[model samples]
Target: MDPWLSMYDFTYHLAQEIAEKIHERNRYLRNGENPVKINLSVRTLLKRLEESIGQLRDSLLRSVSTRQITQLEGDRRQTLIDELLTKERQLQMSFKGDGTEPDVIRSSLMSGGGAGPSPYNPWVLEEPEETRGLGIGDLKQQQQRMIREQDAGLDALSNIIARQKQMGYDIGNELDEHNEIIDDLTNLVENTDTKVRNQTRHVKLVDKKSGSCAMMVVIVLLLIAIVVVAVWPSN
Candidate 1:
């Protein structure tokens, strides 16, 4: 396979995975459930997806600028990138409804997270007995600070689910269009092949008939010579 095509396939698979994670995350958010696990997964996957895309883009740029890439290959890769980016943006906008995703992230971070609530897990914050005495106002202030800090890393995770939904739709649409074209070409090739086979058979049949006629004519000429000799004066 072409390097560009290989890169495209990897990027596309990552994008698809990210999109699915986002959808699952969205459902979690809507239900006011904890999206910490999903969010973390998405973050991990999203990082990989971004890296894959980055590599793919670099390859595409190099190949395309050198005119080594076909227009179709370029279009397929470029279209996927465009669709992924657009879907990301669309999710950011549409998923803005309840805005629960951010709140859940903030809560998870304050509670502590990562690998089942360890000291460094961003999703789980331990509220011990001593801290329980702190006034509500002070606690709010602290939580707000934590939210801000976590949001720094969480900036992209927010509304990611919405984007995945749109991304899936867009990607599917683009693929469908290309698939239809491919189907048409495949059908055309099949039809042409059938015609060629039929013509080949016809040519073979005609050759066989012509050979038989020639053999019959040869036999007839031999017989006529014999008959002429028999009917002519002995000489």
Candidate 2:
């Protein structure tokens, strides 16, 4: 309901998607699938995350313009911003990886070692025949370049994955602390209610006893007046 909460949720989901894409790429690698496709998919996801970051910034601006935020809310928003920035930085790092991947793919092609044409995409165009004339030395050079770029991309992705894992653990810890606080508040409310009910009962018993004492005193005064009247001589 709160705008700050909404932004937090948005950021969380975006981070989750990024993490999933990374894991998906890893799976594709393990399965001996086309690395080019995996690279493309990851690049697309990074672009989407970039767009989402822009939207999140705009959303925060709108929220601030529409209402005055309290100190607590401001702190929360700052925390969310910090988290989003962290993710954004990771996305930028991944972007660095994406930037190198094309070079990696092209070099792989020049070295005659890329994954073959996709069977699922019959409409894809083939490379020019000019690439066939490249000498062995040139091919070796491209292969070396490809290896270097691939290594760089892998390092960036590994860092992003590790950071995402740490963020997840931090979120888990915050949730646990919130749950404990909720439990403590619940116990406090229950104890207060019990004490209130006991006080109410005690007040009612005291009122009843006071009423009985007053009635007994009134009865005794009436009897004393009656006895004095019966014992006195007529004037």
**Compared with the true structure, what per-residue lDDT tens digits does model 2 show for residues 1-235?**
9655775676567665655555455434434465677568767766776776677667667766776666576667766676566655654454345332333333322232225633331111233454344444655676688899999999999999999999999999999999999999999999999999999999999999999999999999999999989998898
TM-score of each candidate structure, all chains considered together: 0.36, 0.43
TM-score: model 2 vs. ground truth: 0.43
Best by TM-score: 2
Clashing pairs in 2: none
lDDT of 1: 0.65
State which candidate has the highest lDDT: 1
Report the CA-based lDDT of candidate 2 relative to the real structure.
0.63
